[model samples]
Target: MAGAQMVNSHPNVKKYLGFALLPQGGVSIGLLTIVAVQMTQLYPIIAAVIMLSVLVYETMGPVFAKYSLTKSDELYGLDKLNESMFEEDTEN
Candidate 1:
């Protein structure tokens, strides 16, 4: 939700796209790694995928932090600034 506008307008779309995809990809890869670990033949491939997923998770930390900072106060009620739920639209 945070990057919806940036998805279309960001100069380096690929970088933003990668930022968006990393978490999803990491989870999928992590699942695959679990399944691969159960099978004996895919050990090497799964190990590499697990490592890649770790890197992906690391890359996603900042993107996650940015969204968390924006929404944390609203979601957790840590502060009460502008608590109106039905403000009139001021923008055209």
Candidate 2:
């Protein structure tokens, strides 16, 4: 029942696909770069760039999520949209 409810609520599987891609996308690229650098004992510059990219994303991600989660605009938008639909259109 709970699984069915969740699927009903989140009708779009694209969200799940998006969540699956996040860590495996840019982060994977960075990890591979770092691993390659260590394997070849090459310039630290490439490794540094990869590490910096990862750190920047890690630092900003939570802040972005928190800000997004706390935003009242979502509730307002939902309420505003629902109100008109539920209310009779008197102008007609």
Candidate 3:
């Protein structure tokens, strides 16, 4: 359960929200590229939507998970120097 929890994330990190949305966008674009090149009349609207989703994803996904534990530990007082919890709050 602890592993599932998100802790010690930085302001520079995407906070998972941005990163999660990005994958959907990437998949949409990829599908759209394949379909658009085919130029079939199956569903142009669907392809367009996919491409649009990709644009949104790339703009947001890479923003998160930017900071690592090493960087946080080095600069910030992460995990109390020897604490395993990666604690940020003094009373958490």
TM-score of each: 0.37, 0.34, 0.36
lDDT against the true structure, each candidate? 0.55, 0.52, 0.52
Please write out the lDDT profile of model 2 over residues 1-92, one tens digit for every residue: 34535666433332233322233336656576667857766546666776676676566755544444344233255677877876756545
Residue 79 of model 2, lDDT score = 74
The global Cα lDDT (0 to 1) of model 2 is 0.52
What lDDT score goes with residue 48 in model 2?
A: 70
Off by over 4 Å in 1: 1-37, 68-76, 81-92
What lDDT is reached at residue 25 by model 2? 34
Alpha-carbon deviation at 65 in model 1, angstroms: 3.9
What is the full ranking by TM-score, best candidate first? 1, 3, 2
Best by lDDT: 1
Deviation from native of the Cα of residue 77 in model 3, angstroms: 15
**Which residue pairs collide in model 2, if any?**
none
- State the lDDT of candidate 1 residue by residue for 1-92, as single tens digits: 34745566444332344344445555666677577758868877776777777676767766864554444332334334343432434431
Error of 3 at 25 (Å): 5.0
